[model samples]
Target: MNNQDIKAKETTKDSKYIQQHLANERTFLAWIRTAISIIGVGFLVTNLHFTMRSTLSPLGNQLATLIGLVSVAVGIVTIILSAAVYVKKIKDINNQTFRPPVISMIFLGVFIIIISLIFGAYFFII
Candidate 1:
């Protein structure tokens, strides 16, 4: 009904903005979880490959083991970078200075799904 009333309404909207920012934080946490899963899978692959090769094919086993290790290392790096970016994004959002250029999450989701499908098929099928 007055200037004070209008200001209160504006603050409420800003609070909603903050809520969305919290949602972003939750989403980033989810990303971290996915990263952990990815890293775990990489380790699992390395171990499983090594165990299967415990009795044969020394050279090929070593190569495959190295590749699995590399996958784990890459997963760690990816997670570290993602965390850094998430913190930067949160800062930008708090300053009200960033609008995402694209739905980065869409790509992320797609990649995760694809990985899941590939791994699932590999394990559950022949």
Candidate 2:
């Protein structure tokens, strides 16, 4: 058979799971968007702190900077973890052995809780 025929065959094979693959891609993109948003929030917090430095006490300024840096780091971790999950899901999908994500979800939940507590303390106690 010609190259075109072989290419067509491969496409047809992959097309069998096109919907699943598309869904996976959409999920990955969503994760990417979430990461970007988290990063943006981090930068916004840092910038706000810098802009209002004169009004904020030294301790408050330091706390804001720390929170901003932590936010950025969390965002970076989210991206890395999401990419790993995406790749694993892709492989599982192809192999027809997909499993629900557990560890990552738990990790994220804990992170959110910690961050929320930090924000609450910063707002109420600081």
Candidate 3:
């Protein structure tokens, strides 16, 4: 084989690496699905505010709308950030670079905490 062909073969990853890359793609897609679900929940909450106007106080409706908007914003941010992170990870993997998972983990944890607090406010304060 020519040097060019040999070099190309050398750079190509094996089946294991390909599997890992596929797994990463699956994970990214899962995050996208989660974001869509969050958006759907947000829309539902906003719609509820209008449908139950007679039963809900003005403040409660406003709170619900705010929560819904925030949820949607968060979901959009998550999708953007997650896609960026996924791309970075894939590049790192291909380059054989070590990447710490701390950042993504912390972001997800904080996101969950914030969502939990919003749920608490919705149930208790609203």
List model 3 lDDT by residue over 20-123, tens digit each: 78888998999999999999988997787678656787777777888799889989997998899798878877777847899769978997898888777776
TM per candidate: 0.58, 0.86, 0.81
lDDT of 2 by residue, 20-44 (tens): 9899999989988998998898788
Best by TM-score: 2
- For model 3, how many clashes? 0
Q: How high a TM-score does candidate 1 get?
A: 0.58
lDDT of 1 at 11: 56
- What is the full ranking by lDDT, best candidate first? 3, 2, 1
Candidate number that wins on lDDT, 1 or 2: 2
RMSD (Cα, Å) for all candidates, in order, is: 6.5, 2.0, 3.0
- Between prediction 1 and prediction 3, the one with superior TM-score is 3
The TM-score, computed over Cα atoms with residue i paired to residue i, of candidate 3 is: 0.81
Q: Residue-wise lDDT of candidate 1 within 11-112, one digit each (tens)?
A: 553464787678777877886786777678777866776677445465545545554676677578778877887778777776788787467668777867
Which 10 consecutive positions of candidate 2 have the poorest summed lDDT?
A: 7-16
